[model samples]
Target chain A: MSQPEILNQAFELGYTYTRSTGPVVGRFLTGLKNRKLVGIKASDGRVIVPPMEYDPDTAEELSEFVDVGEQGEIVTFAWVKEPREAHPMNEPFAWAMIKLDGADVPMIHCVAAKSESDVTTGARVRAVWADETIGFMTDIRCFELV
Target chain B: MSEEEQEMITKVEAPVYLKYNFTAGSAPTRFLAQIKKGVLAGQRCPKCLAVYIPTRGSCGRCGVPTVEEVELSDKATVQSFTIVSIPIPNNPIEPPFIIANVVPDGANVSFIHLMSECVNEEVHIGQRVQAVWKPEDEWGYSMDNIRYFKPLDEPDVPIELIGKLTVTGEEG
Candidate 1:
């Protein structure tokens, strides 16, 4: 009789569904489609790009939209030397906290870099848009070093 | 178009995909090895002395580790079942199939498995069944080695005595 092989199985669990992105975030995504950036005013008057629905400090509904610059600074990042199949990029990249000009809070997004050493704190970067823009976060394909 | 409508995205189609790799534990690994040779085996808890098929490494009732290997027969009794009318994605078997919770003889617990080669409507609790194994050349380290359980000609084990039958032909 042959020995039993170690039981290894690969499986996937997922589903597709439609979701409503109400007012605030909807406006920000809409801005990306129009080749622009939008942010909301926080309770402390800080501009938050990819506008949140509520102010973190006051828990009040935020509606004020402020135009933000596409060029930003890398605040911090985690370097991915080897990317997984599910990751956005196949090559080495950095998942960074970027603070766009005119926005006080940093937003998390990936940065395309040739090597780990290419990314650094406080480095200047600019949004790289996709060829065709849709009202989605991927509209800004990635951030590239400026 | 109005300003509100122009800036709004009411809904968006979001598709999600997640992948995982799973490895069977040591107890099931040992059970699969014997299953590859068309033999049924279970592990017995020393504390409670109850045997479990596709052994879970420890006894659920006694909460103690089970180390004794107990050989079981393919003969089983249907403890409960459901007729699936809806199709499952990526499943080779079609809908309207029988999925049963069956207790293999000599084992104290019931495990879920597919039942085929029998009438779907006639399947019921206490129905006698036996494993329908695939060809020897097709055997592997998976439960798919036994394609499915089919009806057996033996008498139905009484509802009260269903999973209590021991390996030595005695009722517990």
Candidate 2:
């Protein structure tokens, strides 16, 4: 095939993924709907953020629900030079796993900063909200560096 | 259960539909486009002679780019098959359908396509089959171009001869 002809044949394939989150994730979303940041406390008393349905260390279902502070400290993050499809932002942004106050594990989300250099480990950030809110993760627009 | 009660509970009309936008990635787009024209195309790795259905831009084994475009035969053999009694959500086909791994006559890879014109018990490994194109009106650049594969009258081709054609990447 000719170059242009072959190039023309190349097109994008689309797919829709419908994931069924188990009870723990379902309960977490329900809590988020009430504007509550819920965590599942592990057996050792480490309250994990964005409550893990299954404990990574124990491989058991987490049952305890602990309310964590909405505010948190930036644990670590990578500068997303080019955000992939379905990411919170289309433009340049920073994705960080923030360990919320009173929570042990970090949660992944975008951090809003003027530039990558502006974001740093241990930076204090707070959740920003959209004008309208759904119970989904996108409800928190991004963390603004304090 | 009383017949009258059963009849009363059975509602005649049920409407179920799912709406979502699908984006085709790079490799599948080429495969779909060829389906629209009723042509069989496979990706040929220049270095290893591996031909892939649902052609890939690069060779998985050699990790080099495959530049050759090889037109393959529609005739293929059924390596294995399953009667799908449980339907996967969002798929175009309904349940109780036959899906088979069809290894085309001159390619290393086997593609999963619907099997038609045979009883469930009639389907077996090494069964000869040929592509049955959908009506011209319904043709598009997708695997849907060939509606399904049906039993072919040609004698069974040997595994050694079939193996000669470069096996493309693994089954999808």
Candidate 3:
């Protein structure tokens, strides 16, 4: 007839650390700070956005950097109907695999849209830069449907 | 662009934070209900007949369901313990406190709890201890109902007979 008292508590797990991003990743982050997009040349000559330090197939050290376009097409996406507190977007959004212009490989990022119907495969989207561009992935706030 | 803006970034500080709301399960809820009344309770496995305080709803050794309820004694014996010198992150308690793994009479399993009101260096295996509970008004569905354990005046149980005691506090 009466509800039993249940035990509950809020818990927080944290980790704080500093690390060196080395030349390749550091260069890509630096490009974002400068309001530019950078990609690396793969062994097969395909350009990879969010550049890799080495070619995955040949395992060769990659040094060539190519400037890629800010606009891209969504390859696929998962729509978040109910956003959680940890999500980048408070409102409903989509985490999409985007193929930027001039880059063969697609990068995963969040996209802001009015509704799930607004997002589709091959939908064109452009990067929305933050007011202050720091050398971090958050420099590009989120992509918007173009 | 400024020269500093053109300079390459090398290092980054990444701090991660996670939050969650934890809820107690059925077995613990039953145990905490009794704990709110200043009692310790456990579940006994049907297959192994081993009692566990704050029961896991199943026997760890026998893999059988521990459905039979058994009330345990607040008096316990220190099976093992550690005197910490380094402070834990975000915890209010300072260093140099004793944390012990204590097996209560009638329970085959041991649980961790703070040990206080005794010389840290003097705390040893098979030491007899009793729960030092907080005020009745402050009691809730939490292990914190007992502030800490203190040394009891009773003689220490032998090291080999630590968890092998009956409900009446006799050798099992």
Per TM-score, the best of the predicted structures is 3
Q: How much does each candidate deviate at the interface, measured as C-alpha RMSD after superposition?
A: 3.0, 12.3, 2.5
Candidate 1 residue-wise lDDT, B36-134, digit = tens:
888889999999888898888999998999999999988889999999998776677899999999888899888889999999989989998988999
Provide the global lDDT of candidate 3 against the true structure: 0.91
Off by over 4 Å in 1: A1-23, A30-35, A81-86, A115-120, A132-135, B1-26, B63-67, B82-98, B117-123, B151-159, B167-172
The structural similarity of chain B in model 2 to the true chain B, as TM-score, is 0.75
Better of 1 and 2 by TM-score: 1
Which of the two candidates, 2 or 3, achieves a greater TM-score against the reference? 3
The lowest-lDDT stretch of 10 consecutive residues in candidate 1 chain A is: A1-10
Per-prediction fnat: 0.87, 0.00, 0.89
On residues A62-114, what C-alpha lDDT tens digit does candidate 2 reach at each position?
Answer: 89988887789899999988887667887788899999989988999899888
Ranking by lDDT: 3, 1, 2
Instruction: Point to the candidate with the largest lDDT.
Output: 3
For candidate 1, the clash count comes to 0
For model 2 the local lDDT of residue B27 reads: 63
Residue ranges of candidate 2 with Cα displaced over 4 Å: A1-25, A42-46, A52-63, A75-77, A104-106, A116-123, A130-135, B1-79, B101-112, B117-130, B134-145, B151-172
- Screening candidate 3 with a backbone cut-off below 3 angstroms (N, C-alpha, C), the clashing residue pairs are none
Order the numbered candidates by DockQ, best leading.
3, 1, 2
**lDDT to native, each model:** 0.88, 0.75, 0.91
Model 2 agreement with the true structure over B45-90: per-residue lDDT tens digits: 8898788887877899999887677777888888779999986756
- Native-referenced TM-scores of chain A, all candidate models: 0.91, 0.84, 0.92
* Candidate 1 per-residue C-alpha lDDT over A1-146 given as tens digits, one digit per residue, 9 for 90 to 100: 46556788898886756788888778888888887899999989999988999999989999888999999999999999999987879999999999999999999899999999999999999999999987888889999999
Worst 10 residues of 2 chain B by lDDT: B5-14
